[model samples]
Target: MSTQRKIVFDAIGSVTTEQYDDPHAALEPGQVRVAAKYIGICGSDLHVLAGGHPFAQPPTVPGHEICAEVTEVGPEVEGVEVGDHVVVDPIMACGHCRACLAGRYNLCEPPMVAGFRAPGFGRTSQVVPARNLHIAPRDLPWQVLAFAEPATCARHCVGRLPESARENVLVIGAGTIGLSVIQALRIMGAGQITSVDLDPTKRQLAATLGADRTFAPGELDPAETFTGVIDVVAAQATLTEACTRVVAGGTVVVMGVPSGPREIPLPSMQRFERDLVSSGMYVPSDFADAIAWLADGRFDAARLVTDVFSLEDAPKAYARAQEPDSIKVLISLSD
Candidate 1:
């Protein structure tokens, strides 16, 4: 297609689909042209739409969790070719920064994340950096494969867990990230996994998705504590709960991207000597691991996407994702 359809966010609460010139008209070296197959609506996207994400601004194409088929590969790119199904890792970092130098690109300063500060792959086709492409089996549905990015984050967060915290893990929030954490913990051989969320629907889904027990936030006993608490929802209340519910010398992994600053219950955490680790986006290896899980059916990617909309209905998809019962909303770009 010489021209492609794209959804551009023009303002705090406005998004529209419009036609754009071919994204592949001029592909730089080390780049690959992809026909985006499916795109998942993430919590961060909602935050951006609400003018809450720090990296986002008006007049941007907003999407990051993506799955696509290679349409063309630059001469210098290797290991990928046309017709290959792949997941895109949208983190763009300044290579000279300390975080990038140390292989922690997710923590790069002045972050230029695709779909936020840079043009994202929300349209039919776009040119992508070769390094950001992760090849995946084409057998899985594009919607399922689109979860690779979020799954990668969950995988990275699980990798941060200490040995002592592998057992009796409590996952706070059964949203997409939390559900992903539940599956990752199961794959990591966690014991007595418990998931808590405000919505009963998500709690029940958590149980079906491998959580040993699912409970509403209010249903949890005040005295109960865990060796590890993964706060996937990282809002003020959830962060407070995560810090308060950890056992002595336990670890709390914060995986959420909060819209604004909030106070943490640091006194309790410090008194208990609890370790607080903040996890951001994943590295390339994390994306590979997630793809492997999805490839062999080790993880059920289908159940996580609770709603789907066409590329033209991305605005609707974002709104549905904000609903408490919606687990993951997807914008389907291909048949």
Candidate 2:
């Protein structure tokens, strides 16, 4: 059998193409094969290439942000069919695990995401459990449909907030996740939402995506303003700053991940008893919410994309996406 071409990286940040045996075997009665339309390169993929991520894997096909057309469906798959456009949920959890039973599958014991451990979408095709597929709205572009997985993460954050606290929200960072937070807030009836980011491009993108106000972190007033604040950057310093910048009675949501070991003065932030809620990964419900929100035509999210590169150019796309002002990078396979 011939092999397929896949992009893999070395330990020192070098990218190379490798040929593994062709994987055209039919799904084992319950799997789905998706023909790649496009996949988004995540920051973690770049971190893995740069040897900065904890879950680094060299000689691995890296792409979890995937959108595609269903090329084949297993016998048990009742809904998905050939030629049906869909997005991958990308959460490969062991169904028998306790966390999976409780619906907190992201915390599945022996956690595995296909793009990280199994074959990924940085190739012509990939297969996963049909449960991982989320049907995209027929009206949404296939490019944006690729975001359903991350949209799930964003929906998870919004789900954590009180329904009444949707108005006058503050979102920190202008990356894809931040923009997702903005979209969620707007959908829930937030009257005036604000976003803060150092990158002007992302801030502008946030504004275009329904953020009522966009400000550089340096330009925000530290007067304990805003009813709710979401820190998606996950930097200790940035989160600390976000914590301090929010109003006393407000809720501070930390979805951004940061490196190990950081300090924050608890006494300094005790003035108004701010609610510090830390969030982890998503559940199936969050992803369902994300798909439903994507189906909603309230906002124009195509502006979130700034670049689309072919799988052959995955390395360069990963490199350039690290630019200070870059928003999101898409990797196209069918085009």
| Candidate number with greatest lDDT | 1
Q: What are the lDDT figures for the candidates, one per model?
A: 0.86, 0.76
Give per-model TM-scores.
0.95, 0.90
Model 1: residues with Cα > 4 Å off, grouped in runs: none
What's the lDDT for residue 81 in model 2?
A: 78
Candidate maximizing TM-score: 1
Residue pairs with backbone atoms closer than 3 Å in model 1 (clashes): none
RMSD of 2: 2.3
lDDT of 1 by residue, 71-162 (tens): 98887888988999999888888778888999888888777788887787788888888888899987877777988998899899999988
Residues 1-335 of candidate 2 have per-residue lDDT tens digits of: 44566767755687765667875886787799877888887777787777776664676677787888888888888888788888777778888888888888888866576666555667767777898887776677887787777777777888787665566788988787899889878876777899998888788788888898899877876664777788888778777876776666667788888777656557756777777777776887776677776677553457777788877787788887888666678877875
lDDT of 1: 0.86
Model 1 residue 188 lDDT?
83
